[model samples]
Target: MSTQTASSIEIEAFEPHPGWARQGRQPRIAIIGAGMSGIAAVVKLRRAGYTDLTVFEKADRVGGTWRENHYPGLSCDVPSYWYSFTFAKNPDWSHRFAYGPEIQAYMERTARDFGVLDVTHFDTPVTELRYEAPTWRLTTGRGDEHVFDVVISATGVLHHPAFPDIPGLDSFEGEAFHSARWNDDLDLAGKRVGIIGTGSTAAQIVGEIGPEVGRMSVFQRTPQWMAPLPQKAYSKAWKRFLRLFPFVQTLLYHFYYWYMTSRVGGAVLGDEKAHARLAEACRRNLAENVHDPELRARLTPDYKAACKRIVVASDFYPAICADNAELVTDAIERIEPGGVRTKDGRLHELDVLVLATGFDPTRFILPTKVTGENGVDLEKRWDDAPRAHRSMSVPGFPNLWMIEGPTGPVGNLSLITISEYQLGYVIQCLDKMKRDGLEAIAAREEAFDAYNAYLREGLKKTIWVTGGCHSWYIDKTGMPNLYPYAPQQFRKEMQRPDFSEYRLIHEV
Candidate 1:
């Protein structure tokens, strides 16, 4: 690939191969999710000469999470340099941490520029995915069924918003909604707002609404550890330099990746010194922003860093300290007509309610009905706790690959990197199938079980499992199905196709 600005590239329509028109022999692949990861898969596969492909997106547009979550103050915690796809780096990042709209626009542009949009089926959600004897069958929400030789589930975990099932949640007379599904019609000017669950979304929303609302009551179950974000607009000179010197840009990306991945390792497996330093920095950040001792104490996190995601914002603590905002640490008992009632029987009056609770990360590629061999449901097979070999292939699901699958990397590291790596692996598998005339490829049961056990053992030592905090990363059984501590080791394991770990059935 040449070193050019993402905007400079023009997308051309893909022409079908002569073999595609043949009576019975071309391989077809269906990719679910037209997000960054899914687009990456389509681009890579097309470049590798797999012409028969289709991308299905549930929404009318591309950019999965970015297209869905349009809440105020919504932005990526990761730096823009690392957050984007490596193959298509943007030299013109406005902020160090790009906002949702900008990121969404980038994805949309990527799809358009790469011709993935032409092949993508928008406003279509896959209702059912079944594996026939030799091909995978898919049913859309519109009651249309299609078959493919292989399937790739790039449908990410974060897109599905998980609302809390609190008592009397439905009876709240006030305008209440999840942060993912922000209600734009409800005006907050001079209106009291009760925000629930001070996670990343809650922090961002509170900061955004604090200056506008009459009074902002932020409800917190556990305080999040926030870091200072060095967010600033990039200069035109910086973009020029990045474009002129591609090597420098690569070096910069590597430096950021190494630094971030090292921090993840330090938090998950390194000595206590690193964790303590991070904790001290978090405390100093909180103390500097919040003047009141009570408020500072309420904002301090008790668990270890990386147990739950560490938020990055320069304004969140300061916003909470504002006169209009008040942080309530007490558990919410129920939703009264006017406001929320805490466990201590105190009714905090509010006009609007915002649930900033996070997404359902444990339920990987969920809500999409996927059936495998012999009409076996993928959900029932996993039993709500999905497992995958190298977070790619399931035991019984043949020729089905999942990018950013269960137990895949979740923290600090760039998801773009994980997606690229997974896509590469999937393409390689397809290449092998084409070369060897294989009909299907399924993970060996022993290898799948062993990989899951290894992942479980690694999670046992991490702060996400041992720490006294509950997060979306954990399943109902409390297993951490996100990232592992040794990301590099995992990457190396996925560098090539491990045929021994999988069962490859040749075409008869």
Candidate 2:
């Protein structure tokens, strides 16, 4: 095992110069959200010879969703082996499916290792970003204004919590909070817990609180297909081997990536038989876990596995079969002063309410407003849906790149793989601009439109579109805006910069 000390770099102060024409001042780059994507961008930029970069994080720390969602049984749904950055591998993962703190610590370690934390402006939320033809102008919540040559909006779509607009939800007098913003102070011991929504977060919360609470009632709009996670502690021998031989670790990562990606094509786009097999796996898992016939029946999903994101839990089903827990599939009517009332006129009294209703994923690049050429509002352009060329650049937005951007696919694969590819593409663009003395490079409208159309068509055959389940992957218009159908196709498109698809202006 390689013994290395933690980073000793001191966090730097933000020093802003005048606009684009200022001499002796470096061309500044503003990165919104100090999450995995943003931090990866900074590291890649620095490696590519760009030094003047600033990362803005609204929260006090850098772990993004990991730092925010501190609810009970909060852990990564994806396997830890596949969830991390390809560049930085951790040989010391405690569990196959790591908990929240372990994941957050890994992110912190990555930032510190790359010395990106020093240049980050924590607790500074960007209010507005306007393109001033030659440069970009940014205003933060602190009323500070800064100008930059480029901006990268890595503030991921999943951070913002979305509560259902049910009547009397606001009138609930009891302690209520979203799953993302879990109130840790409210003790669940001997309390009647009413959990809404049956997504990943809901499953985790139910498993955790069922053992502790006096009575746990879970309101399920739709059931979720769950797979058993063979989550176990890493043996000392495995850790030693990984630390000693890094190449072996890399090979393992490649193997895992391909294996995971291969499943997507079959699970998402293959025949109904394949989907049925996955559903059977879920059924078998639930039956084996929960001995109670009634509880197993309630936990069984009617839809296919890939229709919604298949959750992985070792104890979630077993927890539901516990004496204190009960599953309610009826629709919620309203929240009375004391408890939640269902459509069947049943009022289930509860001491605390947990809303695991997921996020407002359609609101991409939110909170941080972006203005393109001629005061073009990015939000307005994406009013119908978020679109981008190769999920990186949009038309009229010059020198602006987004990591984990819209129409990018999400699955068991590592986000670091996509982030690395994007960073490479962005850096190559910047390098070309520097070499040719270019002023700006923006995606052409036709290219951007064609890309979106291609992505939409590709998604039609996938389970997300036809699997009879609604998720954050689809927007308000029932369009898939989050990811592509195939990760390989997306990677191939980002392999080389297509200068023809972009309008480049040279510096005179």
Candidate 3:
């Protein structure tokens, strides 16, 4: 974070969109998850004059992953300036990359400040969502059923833990937990810890506790593209300048936004030379951190860069190379009574086993039984792969818009920004519905097919599929789940909503 002075400018109040509020009769809206996306959905809906909004957050708190996953050294990879909501620009962020606790607090404050808590239902989990003609019936975990005119799915993809099914995992007597389901009570100051998976979560955990632990064994399946994190504390004076001068905050956001999109984003967009250059940089960083050539080779990836999620951390390389830490590249044979067995017949003992295995990205919305027209279950329909028109709606699912559907992992951009744009698209649809006196609306089947077709063609052009690597981004059917265009191009497409592409009707 730079300590330069910012020019003070006059700040103006933000106004609600024109005709955003309902006219004669308001529609009842229920938003499924109050995480970043759900919070964005509700915040935008409220600002648009949609007073009848209910945000259902399963956890007692407002933040999603930020609230649930209390893993050590938990911080966002994206810069703090770009990660926050555009409407609620936070100028007092302590670090360049805000950690989990501060971010959760920020979201909670935003909810309270925006009057979202008034209509939000905390500790309420929507068990099932059914669309009966014009209304959506949502059944909660408490057996309470509520009906709404529209159902917005803001439940994030990475909220659920995806544990690997190693043999004898259940028989392990040692204390074990997923990174998302971290046992806060379990102390690991001087205990032996075995963490499975070298993803971002485990990378962060290793950096935090590697120095403190007696012995640390890091299990790796595939090495991620690790990069340096330039995080620094912002001075009080700089924060004051940011707070006093809103334009400076805006400028900072833009700076990070363009910088990230150019480096990593360019690599994903089929730039193999860019990928090789980044790979060399990562190799150099690894070499500088780890003196042993063999250990460095184990840390390197055989696959190309930008194939999987790029993990950013300054201390990861050093953590793994710590005197007490061991990087195990061997494939897991099975789980023993007290430790894990590798293919090389090595039984690593451990007191606490942490599975940082990432979430089920393919599981679009699990455990939520969604029945649309003709009793077509959303879960059953999209079992193999999920699809949505403009990453929002389907042909059978009426008045239902899913944020961050299959068509978006939003490579190389802040997820909050992509989510805000997605919510903007959904809100436009809601505005059209209220203004046109529409009873129900669904994306035309032809439009859905056409969009996915375009997406399929674009995925083949990207490095995710062409590059020699497999991840949650690619579905079972070889369909990569990233937005099928450049970051800026996708934003341009989202800015304009074409109702002609959707089957907007007064009655279904």
Candidate 4:
């Protein structure tokens, strides 16, 4: 038998149950990862009247990143009102930036209330997905095989933790772990703590635990552009008023979305004035906060702001300025049994070592063998670089969609809002399939290539490409693997699916 291209494939349509009529028919949908995106899919699909769906999660619970990272002072940099679901807004957020636990609890409550928990397969990870014309065969970790008409991969980017490769890293005698995999059992109070990587997670930890820890050493490889958080709690009256008049909460959500997207979006998109203003704010924050000239200079970032997703924390500078906290700018030589040894021949002793190194952004829904038509492997296709058509669908992958996938807009803005937009587009495509009696649909290769080309050209105008700093956003191809346009443009693009861009397979 000869293999067929996506455009050339045609297959038998889903047959309706003999007992049930055509109106009662529904496609079996399998959504991977019970994180925010997965939960959003469940709620949105169920409400849209598609009930035959199941979520497979590796972890025992919902809330992907939030559930994983429980480090102290782990709150969202985005405003709480904007970070939450647009459909289900929480009026009672304790602070402007919701804590990790609060976001996790919100996810659980959303899942529970929306009946997602019932349909979700907890602790079950999708090991592989194979497209066998018309349908997708899903293999779970338990060796269970399930076939579905459609599969949506909601496995997020930050789930896999990236560890720093240093000689004798394992030789450290003290408890060591990634920031995402925080050890709740260990008591950090009065303990000599050393944090590697001065990313957002490390800054948050330093801000929260610096005062209490006996001695804190923050090993900074590169300085991050620090932005003022200006986080504050909601008053009792404000909460009560929002609960009474929910429209006010909705108004606040839109306001925040506009504020963040326009400001941050413009800055990254090479708006010189906007970028300069933002960079100035960060510089002013560092200079005004850090009294010592040397410390201020050490804290200042040489690259353009928004290059590495500017670390937002009002308390970080103050925490670093504290008497107990010491910022070590020296390069790390190796890790001894007791602590981290720098190239300056200074050994910093620590009782606990925290690796605040972030995740490998490229490993989204990867390591899972996804074979499309003609046994085209997704991993191999993306071996050099990962690219998805408009950040949702891939070429040759029929009846499959990815939420918050490659080339999606991810930065200081709220991802929940972006995921919702992407989901809206996915649902529309699914609707077309159900309505038009289609067996399979994949992005046209020409269309995929064109869209990706457009993204690369647009990225040329963005700071991610122009900025001198190295960031996870830039893939090996020297192209930033994210939406480089403004959020409004992204929203406008996702507003409607261009049917011509897809290779739709009609049922035989």
Question: Which candidate number would show the highest TM-score if scored against the true structure?
Answer: 4
Question: How many pairs of residues in model 1 come into backbone collision?
Answer: 0
lDDT score, residue 183, model 3?
92
Q: What is the C-alpha lDDT of each candidate?
A: 0.79, 0.78, 0.81, 0.85
Off-target runs (Cα >4 Å) in candidate 3 are 1-23, 272-277
Model 2 C-alpha lDDT versus the unseen true structure: 0.78
In candidate 1, where is summed lDDT lowest over 10 consecutive residues? 1-10
Clashes of 4: 0
lDDT of 1 by residue, 1-508 (tens): 1112322322233332322212245568789998888989888888888877788878877888888899989999877888878778888788888999899989988888888876777777888887775677788887877777778999986877778877888888889888888886778899999888887888888778788889989888888998787788888998898888877767777877877776645776554766777767777888888888878877777887667888877888888888888889888898878889999999999888988888877566668887777677888888858788888888878888999888888674588888988888887887777777677789999998888778777777777777678876677775667766666876787689888998878642
Task: State in Å the error of residue 404, model 3.
Answer: 1.7
In the range 1-508, model 3's lDDT, one tens digit per residue, is: 1011111211122222222223366677788887788878878887888767777778776887888888999999899999989999999999999999899889888877776666667767889988777778888886877777788898877777898989989988989889998898888988989999988898899999998889999999887878888899999999889878899999888998887787778788876777777777776777788889898878888887777877888888988988899999899999998799999999999999999998877666668889999999987888778788888887898889888776775666788998998888888888788778787779999988888888888888777877788887778787767785778888888897988898877755
lDDT of 2 by residue, 220-270 (tens): 887888887777888999999989997877777777677667654457765
Every candidate's CA RMSD: 4.6, 3.8, 6.8, 6.3
RMSD of 1: 4.6
How do these models rank on lDDT, best leading?
Answer: 4, 3, 1, 2
Better by TM-score, candidate 3 or 1: 3
Ranking of all predicted structures according to TM-score, beginning with the best and ending with the worst = 4, 3, 1, 2
